[model samples]
Target: MELTLKGLHHVSAITAKAPENFKFYTEVLGLRLIKKTVNQDDISVYHLFYGDEKGNPGTELTFFEIPMAGHNQDGNNSISALSLRVPSDEALAYWDQRLTEHKVEHGTITELGGRQTLSFRDHEGQRFILVSDENDKGVAGGTPWAKSPVPAEYGIVGLGPAHLTVETAEDTAVVLEGLLGFRRKGTYPSTAAGQPDVIVFETGEGGSGTEVHLEERNNLPQEHLGRGGVHHVAFRVDNEEELKQWIERVRTVRLPNSGFVDRFYFRSLYFREPNGILFELATDGPGFATDEHIEHLGESLALPPFLESKRQQIEAHLKPLDTRP
Candidate 1:
C-alpha cells in the first residue's frame, strides 16, 4: 500500500514542574487537559496531553515531566519553537492583552511566513508562536474547548508549523522531502542578523497545521535538551497497517527506527533524521476517550490496561494532581 503521512500529530516537550505546566496550559493558555497519565517508558514521570475539547490528532501538545531537569540551553539542531493556531488576527490582539493581564512573557503581534504571529515563552522558557488562521487553507484546525477561560474564538485550536533550527538545512530538508514526503513550500527572512532565509516544507493537506520551517545556523552550539526543550515532533498516519508500511520505508532508507509500538490510545513508530531531530509517526485512533468518558478526561489519573494492575504502585510515585474543575 502507498504510504503518506497526514500532518503534525503532536509535539512533545519536557517540563520540570508538572503542576506549573498544568496551570499555565489549562488556565492561562486555555487548552483542555485531555489526559493525565504516566510516561509508559518510565512510569515515574507524568505525561500530560493538552489540546482542544476532544484532544484531536492535530491539536495535542504534550509534556513529559522530569522534576530535576535543568533549564534548557537553547541552540541549533532542535525543534526550536512550537506554533499554536488561534482563530484570526483579531484573536492575536485578544491574546496579547490576555497574556499581559496574566503577567506572561510574550511579544507584539507581527507577520511570519505571510501570516500574523505572536511569539511567547512558557514558564520554563519553552518557545512558542501563535499563528493566525485568518486565511489558512489546509488540514483543518480542531474544535476549541468550550470550557476554556479565554473566549472560544481566542482559544488555541491546533498545532501549526514546527520551527526547526539546525546546522545544515539541506541535510534536514533532504530527510523531510526524500524520506518523509514533505514538499518545499517557500522561504521567509530569518530574525537572526546575517543568517540565511528560513525554508518552509509542507505535507498532507498543506497549511499551518502541516508545515515545518527549517533554519540553518552553523554557528550555534548543540542544544542542551532539558526542561523547556522540545523532545520531538510527530506526524499523523492513518492506521497500524499504514504505519507498518512507513516503517518499511524508513528501514529501506536505512534509518534506525523503533518498530511497531502500542501507546494504548494510538500506535507509533519512532526514528531520527540525519540532523538528530527525533521524528515519530503516530496512528489517529482509538483516542483518549477509549479509557475514560469524554467529559471526565484529565480529571484524574488514567492508566492503560497494561498498567492497570500496577496502578497502586504508580499512583504512589505520582505527585497528587487535582484537575477537578
Candidate 2:
C-alpha cells in the first residue's frame, strides 16, 4: 500500500523538575496540561504532555521527568531545537513582551525560512523557537485552550519545524528522503558563524507543522543527553493498520526498531536514523480521550490499564503534582 506520513505526531523532551516544568508550560506559556501520566518504562517518574485544547496529535509536546538528570551538553547529532506555531507575524511582538515580563530568556523577533520567529530557552535551557504561521497553508493548527492565560489569538497553536543538528548531513538526509519519504523543501542561513546553510525537509501537507530543518556541523562533538534535551521526534501515521505497515517498512529497511508500542493514546514504532537521533512513527487516534474525558484531562494522575494494578505503588513513589487545569 502506498503511504505518506501525516505530519508531526509529538516531540518528547526531558525535564528534571516536573512541578516547575508544569508551572512554566501551563501558566507561563499558556499551553494546556493535557496529560499527567508516568513514563511507561519508568513508572516512578512523570511523563507530562502539553498541547492545545484537546491535546491533538500534532500539538503534543511531552516531557519525561528525571529528578537527578544532568544539564544537557549540546552539539551535533541532536534534535537541537523545536518550534511552536503561533497564529501570525504580529503575535511575535506579543510573545516578546510576554516572555520579557516573565523574565524568560529569549531573542528579539527575527525571520527564518521567510517566517517571523522568536527564539527562547526555558529555565532548564530547553531551546525553542516560536514560528509564525502567518501565511501557512497546510496541516491546520490546533485550537488554543479557551482557559489559557494568554489570549486565544496569541496562544501557541501546535508544533512546528524541529531542528536537527548532525555531523554527516547526507546520512540523515538519506533516511529522511528514502526511508521516511521527506522531500527537500529549501534552505536558510545558519545562525552560527562559518556553518553551512541549514536544509529544510517536509512530508505530507507541507508546512511549518510538517517540516524539519537539518543543520550540519562537522567540528562539534556528539550531544550528551540530560535534562532539557529532546528525547525523540515522531511523525504521524493515520491508524493502527498503517502503524503496523510502517513497522514493517522500518524492519524491511534493516533498521533496528522498537516493533509495535501501544502508547494507549497512540500506537507507534521507534527507530533511529544513521546519526543516532531517535525517531518514531505514531498514530493519531484512540487518543487521550480513550481513558479520560476531554474536560478533565491532566487534572489527576492517569494510568494505562496495564499500570492500573500498580496505581497504589506508583502514586506512593511520585511526588505530589497538582495538575489543576
Candidate 3:
C-alpha cells in the first residue's frame, strides 16, 4: 500500500503556565485561540488550541497546560523545534521587529536550504523558527485570523520544517521512507564530533510544512516529557479509510500501535517509531467547529458528550482563561 501524508495535522506540547502560554501564542505570535477544551484523559488539565482563523489541520499548535510540570530536558528521541512559514523577506523583517519589541529572544535571519529563517524561543524556552517562503503553495490553504495584530499578508502560513533529534538515523530513516513515503531531499554534516549527519526528508509536494529534518545525537541522553516538551506530532490523512490503511500498514510492519481511537473532532492512531518519538496519524474531518459555532470558537469551555456530565466539575477546577482577541 502507498501513502503520502498531506502535512502536519497539529503539534501538541505541554505548557507550565496557562496564562503565559496564551499570551505568547495569541497576543505576541498573533495566532487565533480556536478551541478551549480539557484533555480527554485528564479532565483537570486544559487543552488549548491555537491556529489560523478556521483552525485548519496544518496550522494548529495545541497545548496541555499543566501548571506544575517541570522544565523539559532536551536530548535525543524528541522534536527539537517547531517552524512556521511566512510569505516573504518583508514578512520576516516584520516578525523580527515584532519579536524584538515584545522582548522575545530571537536570532537574526539565517539561510537554511536556501530559505531565510529567524530562530526564536518562547517564554517557556521552547525553540521555534519562522522561515520565509516566497512561493508558498499553502498560503491560500488557511484563513488568517481577522483580528490578528500582525497584518494579514505577514501572518503565519502554518507549520514549516520541524527538527527531530534521534540517536541513529538509520532505523528512523527506514520507517520514514518505507512506511510514510518520505524521500530524502539532502543532508549536511554535523558541526561536532560524535554527532551523526543531519538528514532532511520531505513528504507530499515538499515545501514549508512538509519537511522534517533529522539530527543524529548518539551521545545525548533520552528526553523526558514535561513543560516545553512535545507530547506528539500528528500527520494528516484525508479521511477514515486512509487512516485505517495506515493502521494496517503499521501493524503489518509489526509496530506497536494504539488502534483507532476517536478524539471527538477526529479519529487517531498512534505509534512510537524506532527512535521512540511518539507519532500520531489523525483524520482531517469534523474539525474544531463541530460542537461550537464558527464565530464563537474558543469563547467557552467545550466538552465532548462523554465529558458533558462532568462539565460543572471540570469548569470549577480549570483556571478561568482570557481568550479574547
Candidate 4:
C-alpha cells in the first residue's frame, strides 16, 4: 500500500537539564510549555512538550530532558537548525537587537534572499533562526520576547521549513521522493530567506505558507546525538493502520527502524533516510489532553497508563521547574 504521507508533524530533541531547557524555550524564547511528563520506559527523566497554547502537532518542539546528559556536536547527517519566520523584515531587526540586549549571543542581522535573518544559539548551542517574511503563519507565544519589535499580535508566524545537511544528495533524494512522497518543488531566490541554494519539496502547493526543505551540504562532520541535538524528525500519517503500511514499505527498502513505539499521545515509527538522518512517522491522535485536563495541562507530572504506578517516584526525581522563575 502506497501511503500518502502528510507533512511534518513535529521535531523532537534531547536536552541536558529539564529546568534550564524549560527556561530557555519558555522564558527566553516564549514558547508555551504545554505538557509536563516523563518517559514511560525511563520515568526518572522528563519528556517535556513545548508548543503554541494547545500544543498543535506541527507547532510543537518536544524534548527528552535527561538530566546530566553531555552536550552534542552538530554536523552533517543531522538537522542543522530550525528556522522560525517572523511577520516581516521589520520583525527581524526587532529580534536581532532584542537578542543582543538580553546578552543572547546572536550573529549580526544579514540579508538572505532579500529577507533579513538572524541566528542565535540557545543555552545548549541549539541554533535558531528568525526570518522576516509576510507569508509565514507560525504561531507566537502567549508572552512576547521582551525585546520583540513586533507586537504580540504579529509575533512569529510559524515554523519556517527545517533545514538539514545530508551526507549525500542522491541517496537522500530517493527517500524523499520515493518513500516519503515529497515532490521536488522549485528553486527560489536565496535572498527570499537568506539561505543557500535550497532544494524545496512538499506534499503539494509548496510555498512560504507550507513546505519543508532538504538542503544538502556535503563534506560536513557527522552529527552526534546527545544533549541539545535533534533526536528525530516526525511526519504525520492518517492513522495507525496507515502508519503500519508505511512501516512495511520502509522495511521493504531495507531501512533500519524502530517500529511503533507508544508515545502516550501518539504512536511512533522511526527510521533513517539513506543519508542517515532519523525520521519518525506518528499518528495525530490522543493528543495532550488524553491524560490531563486541557485547562490544567502541563501543571504536574503525567505518566502513560503502563507507567502510572511510577508517578510518585517520577515526581520525586524531577527538579521542579519553578514555573514562576
- Estimated TM-score for each candidate: 0.99, 0.99, 0.95, 0.85
Off by over 4 Å in 4: 111-116, 136-151, 188-196, 208-210
lDDT of 4: 0.71
Task: Give per-residue CA lDDT, model 4, range 1-325, as digits (tens).
Answer: 5566556667788888888888777766667677888766677788888766566666677899877777888788888777666667777777777777778878988764344678888888877777666543323322333333346644654455667777676687788888888877765443324435666766633433234566666556788787878877787777888888888888898899887788878898988887788888888777888887766667777778888787677778887775432
Q: Residue 309 lDDT in model 4?
A: 80
Mind sharing the TM-score for model 3? 0.95
For residue 22, what is the lDDT in candidate 4?
82
Please give the lDDT score for candidate 2: 0.94
Off by over 4 Å in 1: none
Error of 3 at 222 (Å): 1.9
Q: CA shift at 108, candidate 2, in angstroms?
A: 0.8
Worst lDDT run of 10 residues, candidate 1, spans 1-10
Name the lDDT value of residue 187 in candidate 1: 100
User: lDDT tens string, model 1, 1-325?
Assistant: 5567789999999999999999999999999999999999999999999999999999999999999999999999999999999999999999999889998899999999999999999889999999999999999999998999989978899999999999999999999999889999999999999999999999998999999999999789999999999999999999988998898898999999999989999999999888899999999998999999999999999999999999999999999988989
Candidate 3 local lDDT, 1-325, one digit each (tens): 4687987888999998888898899889888888999999799999999999889988899999888899999888999888988878889999999999999999998777667889998998888989887765532346678988889899986888878888888888898898888889898666458676688888886777777888988788998878988888898888999999999999999999999989888899999989998899999887999998889889888998889999999999998987765
**Decoy 1 TM-score against native:** 0.99
Q: Is candidate 3 or 4 superior in TM-score?
A: 3
- Sliding window of 10 residues with minimal summed lDDT for model 2: 1-10
Candidate 4: residue 84 lDDT (0-100): 66
Residue pairs in steric clash, candidate 2?
none
Query: Residue by residue across 1-325, what tens digits does model 2's lDDT show?
Result: 7889988999999999999999999989999999999999999999999999999999999999999999999988999999999999889899999999999999999989889999999999999999999989889999999999999999999999999999989999999999889999999999889998999999999999999999999789999999989999999999999888888888999999999998888998999999999999999988888898899999999999989999999999999998884
